[model samples]
Target: MLRFGLVGALGIILAIASPALPAAAQKRFPSSAGELTVDTVASGLEHPWGLAFLPDGRALVTERPGRLRLVETDGKLSRPISGIPSVMARGQGGLLGIALDPEFAQNRLIYLSFSEPRAGGNGTSVARGRLNEQGTALGDVTVIFRQMPTIASNMHFGSRLVFDRTGALFVTVGERYTQRDQAQNPANHLGKIIRIRPDGSVPADNPRKPGWAGEVWSIGHRNVQGAALHPDTGQLWTAEHGARGGDEINTPKAGLNYGWPVITYGVDYSGAKIGEGTAKPGMEQPLFYWDPSIAPSGAAFYTGTAWPQWKNSLFVGALAGGLLTRLSTEGEKVTGEERLLTDIDARIRDVVQGPDGFLYLLTDEEDGKLLRVRPAR
Candidate 1:
């Protein structure tokens, strides 16, 4: 009896000392979609950064610490799948994003973007791999697209993989923070959006310029983190992070320059003015921008029928703000904004729509969670 009492007392003391754990399974919250419930599908993920739903409803998830996991439907996370390339898991770098082939069921191919350790330091690179039948490992892994002039910095590896309707892959590259000025220089891949074929070849139709890389689709971007193809227009849309302010949403067109260091609505970290004011004659402007930065990440447009009111709404996960941002858009312009799930107070790293018409989210914590959003009973 004495031993049992001591163990019980210790459990209570530890619970009091530790921070509150997020509610298990399901919790209710109010939102524009009416009363909704967030179910904790799985926990104990280490900085989970990407999520890709398989045809079987399982998901391939990546941890920033260099592991790929398969999350089963019943909330079991398979052991780290084998054959992930050696990643330079440094600051703002690591295994970043993943995308499925359009015909994944047939080809079993998947693409991943991660920071690759190079001779100098590291840069973001995309790799393609085949998932074996048992789903226990990735095989035939091949490095497809590698960002140019591999620098030594660890910050600003904007590496999201998105595929267009014509099957072209769009890879977003960052300016490697310390090299923000290169974002304006087309001589390198830094700070540009590049479109390439699945086989890692530059498309013949890709934009061409004297000094621009052949794979360059657009240039003059800051660190773009969130990106998705518009459900209605099929056009590529991206979310970018500004210095101190000026978080922006942009629809990047081929060969266009998005004013970053040259023109910005943000100031530097030291509170100094940045750029030559906010506009330039030839530079493209953002569709919408946030003055106080939200540090936006993975994005998805709600096309699922689970919530009719949320249809066509663009959902973006906020890492710094610890919430989900819903932007109501018409045509190419943002009309309204709704910030939801702030009460959870977790850093939302990725937002995705499941095949079951429900929404899913990844929290970027030491012990991150895979959460599902559905209507509350």
Candidate 2:
């Protein structure tokens, strides 16, 4: 069982296991979709994933190799910012998402997601800190939320952080590549989107039974890397990677089960079908799905002024598909889908709208890049 106390810990060193992909599955990578143009805004980064625009017109990026960087508006990359704690970078686990406190104007608080070591094992953790005067190192850091009951596996640490309009925080955790069953259990944090206070306390209004923990907002997911609240509806939306197929975009209701391994439209990596047949009665279906798997990561709604025709569309980053997907949303339904930047062929890991009204993306790779997207004339 997972324990719930707090202490400084170190992750277990992985034994250099063989690659998780099946032998026959290895092939040329970087999938691309329909035609849409993309342009590079900046280059020269190490596995850039998460992005957060600061109030000063600069943006902060988290590289999976455990570095936090400051990118100015003119595309200049600052020296690595300090104060990030140690992280386990084995497989998909590492420094993940970044978000400023909704009340950052007064508090100067920021949140981060990373894989932290713990007793008996390691798991995904969230920490908070303040940026220093020089915008370099973070100071006054504290761990707000840490997954209990660490395990030995090193894959599927979802670790996406987003602050809703109400100042409540939503965190996503993968099933750790071993606890697939926990995705359907209300008792576990794995494969779930958790809702908490900015200070890391479980809110009273969470979808818990009278005596159960209240942090669980929705359950039954598989590595949900992208989560964002709809700009007009105030509803929460998420994108998750499926096994061999069945990438999904879902709007989760309080207490709804999303049907991960139990009823997936996807098959296992070995080409075996997963779960019972799709469409279980109690589980919610995806608002949209991608077959052959886009391996989606970050997501956000486009409310910026630069893209006049995309005023309320949803932008999703694809890790496997190597493109950004634009979705049309109306009343919680996805009406149309378009693939963007298929020609660039970069692993688009995170997408966010800049305060300057342009779209930004961070690529995923050993040598990744930071890119900006605008409407082509």
Candidate 3:
């Protein structure tokens, strides 16, 4: 029941209690879109991860512990909707991302990404189901995609789902910490962006040859968590975590190599060198990178008119940096950067522009919150 003003105070206390960011990681800039205010829409969520608004103004929220709930327009949360598949729920793995079908109004279909457990081990997976008419459960659930080479390690499940204009689903996958080299292998799904039809079939025009596993769109990513289709160009952009540094924002191209372990701006956890260097012969450089990692999560392009200055800008949630990053872009290039909500001191997990022309964010914590952001009157 804490209010927004009280939440600000709580954030300040949290900043004081937590360890300070390193000098290189302290990159806070003033917002250019004038004064802004944050309102707490809902609280007491257990590590809320993904958010998607329904046509009726209610929002579908996913918690990392594998529960899905509906948040009413007035911020009341409904009981956990039934019919969710069992998730592995291990370290850095659980129910991760959720998205509504482009034609959800008609089909009532929804998609979810999670860590799926199997006999050998667990891997990232995507499932589709129809929301029951009573909104109490899901029906006709089916797993559409599963990451290949299921490994035991629980970290580095790079999962975020986005649908392209043509109705293809783009899925991000991570290189399961110990499987960095596999990112370069076309035979596996680790460290790659894969595009598939809603029914789990590979599109004939996929970049890979017919013999290759027809799902991979690009390769050599580290642990991508944030993904969005560019509002202007319709291109796919992603934000991924690095080892110690080298957090990157990239626009993935078909069949291109991103050069993760082979070429990285980050070093190992032990301060050892990662790749040959930041550059290699055929790898593509990121549109932007953070030297000290921000640990970015979900992302959205601000297409709302409520904040005209933010229109077409890219907003990403920062986990380690504890802020919302606004990247000003000119077409495909990032022109400027600003860090917001630093005073909130919450690990921002997701950012979505609401249908009502406001921005919504999910804070990651034991007592996570759904926050609304708008221009101050």
CA deviation > 4 Å runs, candidate 3? 1-30
Per-residue lDDT of candidate 2, residues 17-38 (tens digit): 1111111211121212212224
lDDT of each: 0.84, 0.76, 0.83
- Residues 1-377, candidate 1: write the lDDT tens digits: 00000000000000011111133556667676577778788899999999998988888899998999998867788999999999999898999999999989999999999999999888999999999988898999999999988999989999789999999999999999989989998878999998999999998888888888898899989899899999989999998888888888999998899988899888999999988998899999898888778888989988866566667888888888587778778889887777777677899998888777667889999999988776666
Q: lDDT ranking from best to worst?
A: 1, 3, 2
Off by over 4 Å in 1: 1-24
- Model 2: CA > 4 A from native: 1-37, 210-212
TM-score of each: 0.93, 0.88, 0.91
**Which whole-number lDDT from 0 to 100 does residue 118 have in model 2?**
71
The lDDT of model 3 is 0.83
Error of 3 at 167 (Å): 0.4
